[model samples]
Target: MSPTPEAVDLSQQRALADWLPGRLAAEQPAILVLGDVMLDGWWSGSIERLCREAPAPVVDVQNRESVPGGAANTAMNLAALGARVSVAGIIGTDDAGMDLRNQLVAAGIDVTYLLDHPDMVTTTKIRISSGGQVMLRIDDSARSVPAEALAELAASVRSAVEHQHAVMVCDYGTGVLADPVRRGLVDALAGRDRAEPGVRPLLVVDSHDPRPWAPLRPDLVTPNAQETARMLDLRLPEGQERVAEVSRHADALLEATGAGAVVVTLDRDGTVLLRPDGVTHRTWARPAAEKQASGAGDTFVAALTLARSAGLPLTASLDLAQAAADVVVHQPGTSVCSTAQLSRYLKAFADTALEAGELERQLELHRAQDQRIVLTNGCFDVLHSGHTRYLNQAKQLGDILVVALNSDESVRRLKGAGRPINAVADRAAVVAALSCVDYVTVFDTPTAAPLIRQLRPEVYAKGGDYTPEMLAETPAVEEYGGRVAILDYVADRSTTAVVNKIRDGEGAVQTN
Candidate 1:
């Protein structure tokens, strides 16, 4: 599979930042989560002594926390991303089940379909931690749903699927994926596929026994390295040709399962997405030396499902999902990532609204809309009223205003080391946030002349202080039938003066 040329980076994050909020607010995607629902309980304390009888560390419990686990965690993740979420799963008629349902409801998830069975015990995984490390774990649960409960659960899922845009089956070796229920869901999805055609609800399966889901022909299948290896009955590949090997394995899995796409998560090595359209996208994991990976996989699937349901492209969805997982894995204990957390994460990384390559593509897209592109270059290190006024006037000269910012290295080379108190990323983010700027990109050159020629904007703009003859990029602008427009700056409004006054311990003064 050939990878898409425009890799997802800060540019993609900006687009998502704009696209996701609106989509989430205006056209929320409803999703149904069906599978095993468990409660994850944790006890953290300090350990200073060992047990006299058993020779085990004795942890004096100080605090305890409970969170939704298993498939319920996936539902929580979806709600955290602002998706309209409902969960359909089985739990025991016990305190753990009640706690799990309460947490899910508190997270704004619809838990009406979560049924309780008298005979079955709710799956509970309890961890005892001391000094920030897990000392021991005790598990209490039943893996299988009562035979009599399967029919009712299946009926609930079938009814729920009709109203949702997607259905995610999270089978964690639980009997929730019983043959009868699985078959009913598959038929329901098949009917949806036929009735709605292109807009049918997506069927996504993340299961340990992936082969059972093969006949269902799910739209997407997510399997980890070990799960993928076990399902395909093959040894995991390492080093040198790992990418190719994993890609090949993913292809075989897709073929075997009849899934439209397969995502094989390679732990810290990152994730690989394979689509039958012959597009393969791979994203690296964010740096984390120490992390608690509990519930990270569920977070990944939830984000990916929501992004795809909101109509984002496959590559963008993959990148965003991976980013969400990255945020959760770095936190302590089992955690769910909120939309605000994701936005902050992306903003920090992609300071500039666009990268150079992304800027080029965005320009082309604008040109297609018959929008006139106005170009300007500046340090924009410390935005003052003068800069804002100049940018606003420049925007009026054309339909779209593109700002080319100088990189930190270039600024240091030209304006001395003391210049640019803010880094390039911060400067770019500040400029891009302005309403007058249509796009912002950082260039690593002494002058904008080279970039000017490449962009070939319709109108090249500058402040009144610089005449056409003194500017190095004038000729390049003229070469593309683009004339220079020098707008008057706000008098006495200079960033240098602002800095000087602050350094001199002067009082605040109006510059513009």
Candidate 2:
């Protein structure tokens, strides 16, 4: 249960970010993500231009996009976290479903489980925004995959789990985790058929059911404070008694669910973690923006899976998740956190190419490396100690740290005119050249949420003043049992400072 090298964060603005890489180095055994597969779409533009054709502001159109949602997100996260992903979820035989499956395959997640049921409309959630402010939201998806499809999915997952390092059962409560199929998925991983004994395949379950938990006895189950309370049926407050009770409840819950360990995330208070090794701990998130929590939990649990698969102990796994979560929850829209983005908040690991031109290629190349992916994004205008510390720390979160830099266009849209002082290529290189960075790409969105969701790193990271509970990435990161948190800020170190000093020409400091 002790924190391993991967979880050790040199930045310590919050939790350890060192364990990420080693934790993600595992073979990324073919993971069977059996659950929801969805599409998350977003429309971004300016309110100033609403609809010129109507009385509404002429909303200047920026762009439209989509990524995996629900169980699919879980699958993508697994892939990002360095696991060879083979997802089994039903999608309609429509364009959206096709897009979802295609994206998963393109991102390196096996789509063997992505069933195309003609009766269903692929699950999708669309969010529209302008100038960093969310203006509207849309939901277009079904509650469940077809019954027959679910049964087939169960069989597919059962077979995949045989060869997988672990089977992640992502129950989003959205039809995907139907009681019947969900239970079957867990049992399959538990070696019910006496299939491949001694392998002790890990069963990672992320769901809203306390009753179902015990029946499956998964290796690990991640639940937020509120969800923990509901699942454990406790009214415990935040205190020693609460910790003890929560642990006991979690233990009982663990026993009931047959899970080996329980990691309960306590938002701002960091995380109240429990491990089978008889250890418990708490960690904090970095200080960051406090707005829409689109994809925090997904990032957190994703990090955990990656860390665990990479051989990181529970302590290191939790620590890495906390730090990664800190990085993701501070943005305005559905965001993402790449290993590179979180890398600044990680450790002084290895660096990767981050130029805009090389990003896509880098992504493809890394996708071929057979490693879990930890993704995070940011502007990184002027590199600073905090940034380096964060990057190095993030490297510990997964095997391959991919940083998503803001494209020149994205910078202009997000930071306003004259933004991204460092062009996409320059910014990418600056971040990529750092020993801590792995791979770098360009994202033209306000936040890395979308990219994080797509990349679905094992852990998502951010830098700021928030605790784990206070961390914005909490809910989303935890959704798929991923952990989230902020990295300790580098005290007074900041890119803004360097920028100011240089602008004044009275600065005595060095520039990257």
Candidate 3:
């Protein structure tokens, strides 16, 4: 049996968080989003009384706004994440279609291929909400696109795919991606020599029912739990059981969807990625929020497509997609995870204390990126200017500076009683907050030799008048071809000196 899929290593998570923003900025991958396009309208107001005609609460509508939905939302998410995005689909020539087109243009998305059909009704969902809860939804959509309109969309998609780096098929069972469009997509993809490496436009399919598009042979397909269950014609149990059932049918799902891989997203249960070779990778969901917004799946697909198009490993792309989805779930309404928001979320991980294993994994990722690692250990019971200055100097020596703090027990063992004014957790937090420090971890050892050997940082830094002979970890560093560097120490900058001054009350004010 394949081993259980573990969460993405914390270090890798940190590395992806740091790498994605810069990569997206430099590449600005052009992605074509095709399939159903719609506008989502929100009518929010106060429900103070019941309506005379019915028992339902009467909503005094106070606000009305519209945003992209379905495939358009997916395109919006791609645009938000710094991708050069264009949308292709069928919409009506009505006001709703015009509104949707305007919104897409305003968000910097190219709508050249978003065709308007005189006979079709623009797919629009108007949801009435009150006090942050959805009350009712009214949908307007055409059952099918005219054959001529479908032909036009297929032609546009064929041409658009030629210039794009990635194509996202967001099929919502709206007939926008009809038989003609699907056939065109298959021909276009096949003509691109997709089997070869470094193809220009990778194809990703996100559909309500993906089995029909099996001929396209997409690189990735994202189907939520319910969608997966429907495709399989079986009821999947909740939680891990659902994940196991999906794993057992991984090969079947691959064959059914004709995708290189399938990611089955389980709301509040994270996601499970299934591949053709029986390899599965899972990402655990963040703690469930009391209430969450919608369209996180679209956010996931957008990030995943962008990451994959940028040549990130498939597993890493999955993790990045999960992180983006996590960002949007906590927000209200249909939301998108912007590049800045995702960066901030990932940076938050750096402030928390990591175990030795996690820290080592993080360092390995740094090494992979050819970044220099600097390691330093101390008992920062109280943060002061001296500590900050020393850390800044240490950071200057390398690309990533890791601060290791002595655990409370170790601090007390070394300094005797009444030492370590703050606990290791608190100390790690303070040290991590320093702009120069990239990561923080707690160590209980009397010396930092174990950590130095495990992390194998390029530079083992210390502050003060200490030579290689004075440090216990010098041999450990030298054994691994690493070097020890001593940074300049400011006068009267010791934590001991600060504690003594406080105890002596030298800086205390005299009361009248």
Candidate 4:
């Protein structure tokens, strides 16, 4: 039987967690971010009284911070994800522009193509908040870019696209990506050599109105529900209804945006990818706070673009992008997901204990990727340094490590009454929390022979110094051309010894 959607999602998430760190480390793809660039300002303070001038709360501004917004925010996120990023946009020669430029430079983004227009006012949005509630927002982006600035920006776009692996267009209905600029982008995309398969640079559009750039034939276009509604000129319902509506019009959206795929982001409901092949891939959103910072969509686009440029599958790239968006939604203000932060967030998926069926399905995926799987089983009643060392050693024997735990009933039957001071759930959670263990599952069987035979991992590891003939599971392993490995055992580190010592009150207990 085919795996369920939930099972597939779990398997994909696990694979991404294991694959991202290495993939990000090996390649630093160059990406060019083009479109409207703005400065986001946050002014937060305490509010104790109403303003005398108007019916509004008075905010005693205590702290003020500024960060990049719009297309520049996308560039910041790309840089944080370890991409060699360059930004092409028009910004006024004002203080906000200078601050945005300095921040982008400090973040290691190439700003050579950031054109400075003397007459235009740099786009800046400042939010005033007190006690976690936004009081008012002030915008300073009224002037339009002159013809001279637009010409310069168009030239810069043409030049920047030559060396980039991907171009991410972030259009907020701003004048920076004017007709001239878009023509330059389209001409540059058309001029690229396509003699070799997969040689053309990817074009990803994250615009409020994507129809204008349809001529460029973007590889991907990300539109939220509102933007999708605008494109279709139909008011969408809430929740799953909206998703269904978008799916029904997938062909129209594809044709309208001229994109190979369209990813419609449904906010808390997560995102869905629609393709011309009539295949739709959906990623459910992980748990996140209701109140999130701005620029999460920018983070998603940055990650999606980077992943695609790195040659990841479309579905996998969407999953990674959703993961990145999930990470930044929990922070305050405009935030970016760094490589280390994204890696850690992905690794957190390993903490979930899977059922035997799900575990087997996930193992199949790992095996198909040519990753050797190592299986080990034990009570793991009380996790300690000894158990950690053993698991680490087992992980070194293979590319993926699977730890099986004895259920409560099985633990009691094997170790007698008062055994397993910790329950099976607790045991599995603790073992899965270890970095060395990739997957954890519970079994009620008296022996692990059945699981070993079912999984047929490349190696079956045991911590004790026992010969293969002494183990019941050894035969099961050998029957399938799998080897049995014995890991190093730490003496005097048994769980029984620790429990006995605690019962005897022999050691000083530490308190938090």
Best by lDDT: 4
Please give the lDDT score at residue 73 for candidate 3: 89
Taking the tens digit of each residue's C-alpha lDDT, what string does model 4 give over 160-231? 888688999999987889899999987777666543345678889999999998998999999999999999
Q: Candidate 3's error at 198, in angstroms?
A: 7.0
Query: In model 4, which residue pairs have backbone atoms overlapping below 3 Å?
Result: none
| Candidates 3 and 4, the one with greater lDDT | 4
Candidate 1 matches the true fold with a TM-score of 0.68
The per-candidate count of clashes, in order, stands at: 0, 119, 0, 0
Runs in model 1 deviating more than 4 A are: 1-22, 193-198, 239-241, 352-512
| Cα lDDT listed for each candidate | 0.77, 0.64, 0.80, 0.81
Question: Residue 352 error for model 1, in Å?
Answer: 7.1
- Model 2 segments beyond 4 Å from truth? 1-23, 48-61, 190-193, 234-248, 275-278, 291-293, 330-332, 348-512
lDDT of 2 by residue, 172-269 (tens): 66776675676566667666447666776667887776457566667788877777777666676973345557777655766655677777766654
Task: Indicate whether candidate 1 or candidate 2 has the larger lDDT.
Answer: 1
- Candidate 3 — which pairs collide? none
